[model samples]
Target: METTYFTKKDSIVRQIWGKADTILFIFAGAAAEFALNKAVDWLYYTGRLPKDPLGRLFSTVNYAKVIVFAEEKTAFQAIDQMNKIHAKIEENRGFKIPDWAYRDVLFMLIDYSIRAFEALERKLTLHEKEEVFQVFLKVGKGMKIADLPTNFKDWEIQRRSQLQDNFEYSDFTKDLFLQYKKHLGIIRYRLLLEAQILMAPKRIKELLNFRNQSILIAIIPFYRLSRIFKIDYILKELILPKDYKSDIKALDHSAAH
Candidate 1:
């Protein structure tokens, strides 16, 4: 089947998201939010994240992948389904999820989309960055999030404020890191933390007590060098989790429509 413009087989978003390393890096940033954002943490009261943080994150990534790469009708359905799920969570919680918190998640997607791609590949053009912003802007519109900025520049300003207002170092943050350590092992968890520190907003790094550093920045040169040598797959295998190795391997640069 032919792809639509949104998920066109060669679309920039598809190619960015199709790489497993990019998805993982995106979640590394998102992981900081999940750990520190109190309002956002309320959405996970089911204890799923506490038990299996990586699994919960991958579930979110899978939902987004379906929405991004599926055909228009199917993509809309996936999005509608996601909205309904959030609505149900709010109903059960007996209070509305705050709009700022909703926007925070949207911003993370936008920020991490850029961070992940730049880490793995070359820097995107300004136009391409706007495209990343637009894709998630559309997703947020589908979920009916209120007061989103009209464009990427405005959104970048608002995103910084949201990060400042929404996140902190709480007991939830402490426990979530412990869970990440349990799941990823000590070495991988340290790597994950460093990745998060590198990609997170400056305030978030302060809240997490992580120094500003990019282990990935130093390593990205090697990643790019490997790509030039066509041995990138070897490095990817070494970095990703053994349990999800097969699943990550299946991600393709040009997924079928």
Candidate 2:
């Protein structure tokens, strides 16, 4: 599925068949990614540090990019270079980012950057445009928007109403209903913390599963990593218990072996 967070790919499948499963998948993705983003931000701002310079660089850049640019990739790249210097210093400072975590963060940022570029380049549909705007709102951008419900049935009426009153809704109005009618459309979506975090291209239509009255339903993840106590654990757990016991294992395993 294209959308890691209740997005385009799932929406498309829901359209063709009106399947509840696909709709739920999209909502799950959205909520999952949304929560992860927020938690990552909170943990980061709390001054937690990864034992690697690269991780430091990635986290810093991610937070700054949102605050400063609000999804503007142009600005992200501009500061990204400065972050390179920080990366170099981190090595000597006794902090080092692992190759996997480093790669994951970079991949996600790249994916998001590409999406931003495409939307600007290709004139996104009115609803698509609103989705992007809502993304910014979720990430703590300056512009304020309402917190949409994660349920399709509830969101369908609420979000449409918001768009109608808040945005310059013209031809876009019909498009929203059509997408929803297809049963592949989403009223709400989010990101979350989970075993496998799914990520998707920024543009929903770009997902591979696009088709007519489509038979396939899909679920995608931003990506997944094992959970742990974030004060410090140089190694990624990749899998762990849901309760507090697992964190004990994480802390011990993290000790120099």
Candidate 3:
């Protein structure tokens, strides 16, 4: 009898496993993980253990909305993450998640996480989903939920200083946010960048034209709000500039004219 001749011709998914740029992936993954942890913590904190039963339930629903809305707006941050995942896997091997597909994955993750909580005991309807997303987005995004205020300050100082050096090239109001002195306030410095991105959403190419060249700061803002004057952006933009923070003249300039 001619015994079994089995050849597993089927190959693994090229889409799933890309390559292995481990270092980049780790840092990128850390960012993604960090965001999730904070959101989850928010859930836990708001999930009333005792107290008013109806109010506690409402709070949980409110929190869920925040998570959903976050995904909707910051969906691109996750898409950007695919590049991180793709880059790492591509290094070892070669696979990819297309740009078009990224949006779906982001929504799926957002919905799944919330649905999971709702399924356990609370029966969630689609209407509830919509309500949660819109409401949370309005409230949470402004709160700077995941980031510390100091980070926001550093970025503002750095961006403004850099702009001061090259303000002539300033196209529009690409505001850089710094902490208000002696208090927790984020001040904004104008930049040419925001003028384009916000003023004209349809002319996307124009918005990105000055990207890499806009301001190459070592401290990249959290990949999520890399666009905004986020704190992570500050760490990378300010801490890494050559002699920027230490140069007494620059410091004086920041204070003076």
- Give the top-scoring candidate (lDDT): 1
In order of appearance, the predictions have TM-scores of 0.92, 0.22, 0.20
Angstrom error of the Cα, residue 207, model 2: value is 21
Q: For this target, which candidate reaches the highest TM-score against the unseen true structure?
A: 1
lDDT of each: 0.80, 0.30, 0.27
Error of 3 at 158 (Å): 43
Model 3 quality (TM-score): 0.20
TM-score of 1: 0.92
User: How many clashing pairs does model 3 include?
Assistant: 23
Off by over 4 Å in 1: 1-5, 253-257
lDDT of 1 by residue, 65-156 (tens): 77778777877788899889878888988888888888877888889889888877778988888888888888888889999997889988
- Global CA lDDT computed for model 2: 0.30
lDDT of 3 by residue, 165-208 (tens): 32121211121111111121222112222222222112222323
Q: List the residue pairs that clash in candidate 1.
A: none
Evaluated at residue 92, the lDDT of candidate 1 is: 85
